[model samples]
Target: MPRPEDSVWAVSVAQVASRPGQSKPIDTVFPAPAGIGDSVVGVREGADIRVVGSFDSIVDGLVFTGRFEAPVTAECTRCLKPIDPDWTVPVTAFFPYDSGACRDDRRTGHGKDDVEIVAGEDESEDVYPLSPDGAFADMESLLRDTLVEALPLQPLCREDCLGLCPQCGADLNEDPDHHHDVTDIRFAALEQLKAQLEAEQTGR
Candidate 1:
């Protein structure tokens, strides 16, 4: 059986978990978990992810408040240019001391229903489970969830990208004057009829 502490994402919090009002600071790097996003816009798996934050102990759980920084790779939505940038996201999550008790309470309808309802109403913070012995808090799921939610759906290299020309697929940013002289469709039939009359007069 693998130990919880053996995991790379696990952080030992036994010192702070012993009592309320204690705090533990964390400043370290962990590998990015898989499935943060897709090829279009995402952080690569195994990329370095920096976490800077602290865990504060409360009566029921530990509250982690910090920032996550990772390398994000994406393409510009308008121009289709490749872009790689560092993305920073603020995160706050709860590592409950007794997750099983909370689950049992919900199942049996026997404890703290009002408290649970009030907690559920505030969707800003996320909740995760600590190790069975409450000695370690694994952050794999939290990191994945945070980064995934923070990914931009429509990423851009620049705000005012001109994109590609519709007629010839030319880069509008590179060639601002590039264009085609297109005759109006409404005048096409009349132009053809006038040409035919001229041709017939010449033949006659």
Candidate 2:
């Protein structure tokens, strides 16, 4: 069987988990986990992801407050230009000591009713499980969740992108004054009739 600490995302927290109020600083780079986002806007798998923060042990769990820096690839929603930017996301997640307690609480119907009653009033923090021995905290799911949620719904190359021309498909940012002389549809019949009469007169 594979050991929990063997995982790439696992961080050794045995010392901190020994007592409450303990602190452990985490500053390292891990490979970006899969499923962060779609191809249109996402961090590519195996990309470098830097995490800088600390884990503070509470009475029953460890709270991780950190910032994630990742390289995100996307296309501008309006201009359709390729954009690659370094995205930074702030994250706070809980790694409970007794991981099975939450499941047991729900199974026994103890906390389920209370949760449903005050679901609107409560804002639940992201919760992850520590290793069975409580020695390691795997960060794969946390990293994936944070990055996915922070991805921009509509990415833009720039704030003032002019986008493409609707009629000619020309890049408006390159030629701001580009346009077509469009005759109004309301006066189309009159203009065509006038042109036909002028042609007949010229022919006569």
Candidate 3:
């Protein structure tokens, strides 16, 4: 296949057709998203991706896959700052079923669950791209999406996350010594009633 001018960038294949286990190829690193919040940009490294085959039949499907230890530079959960977070996903996926057979298979997580894989389509792209002409998807988009989907509805820098305090909008984790108390709206009425009762008793 055609490659870029950089010799450092190359695609390699393993002995897979012979063993019917995995077909090897060079991996690529995609770009990350802009701004804060959870992002999926793995450290760039030259690794191999293999396409595994199913034993039952030779259906037009994506082959064997694997996951690598992906190192993500993210912010610390506590400080709202960047931190190197190690994240991983099943990098290898199969467009196993052709046009008809490719059903939404969420339980297994190998095939399309909500997204649709076109039939009679070229599987040449990356696994995560809208187009996978190279059998490699854009890791940034795919992994980023996974990271966002997996993140808590409410994110924290850390478990003991010092969230923004309501009163002063300060990080509780940063300055634990600071304290504040809220006024009691409901109890204010009760206090007034108590004063009236005290006056009635004193008067009687």
Determine which window of 10 residues in candidate 3 has minimal summed lDDT: 49-58
- Preferred candidate (lDDT higher): 2 or 3: 2
Off by over 4 Å in 3: 1-19, 25-28, 32-62, 68-84, 96-152, 187-204
Q: How high a TM-score does candidate 2 get?
A: 0.85
- Each prediction's RMSD over C-alphas, in Å, is 3.0, 4.1, 9.4
Question: How far out, in Å, is residue 3 in model 1?
Answer: 1.7
Question: Pick by lDDT: which candidate is best?
Answer: 1
TM-score of each: 0.87, 0.85, 0.43
Q: List the residue pairs that clash in candidate 1.
A: none
* lDDT (Cα, tens digit) per residue for candidate 2, span 1-204: 989999999999999995878999999999999998998999999999999999998756688989999999999988888999998899888887774654565457666643342232224648788899999999999999999988999999999999999997899999999999998999999999999999999999
User: Scored by Cα lDDT, where does model 3 land?
Assistant: 0.42
TM-score for candidate 1, residues paired by index? 0.87
Report lDDT (CA) for all predictions: 0.87, 0.86, 0.42
* Top candidate, metric TM-score: 1
Better lDDT candidate (1, 2) = 1
User: In candidate 1, which residue ranges exceed 4 Å CA deviation?
Assistant: 102-125, 185-187
Ranking by lDDT: 1, 2, 3
Query: What are the per-model numbers of colliding residue pairs?
Result: 0, 0, 30
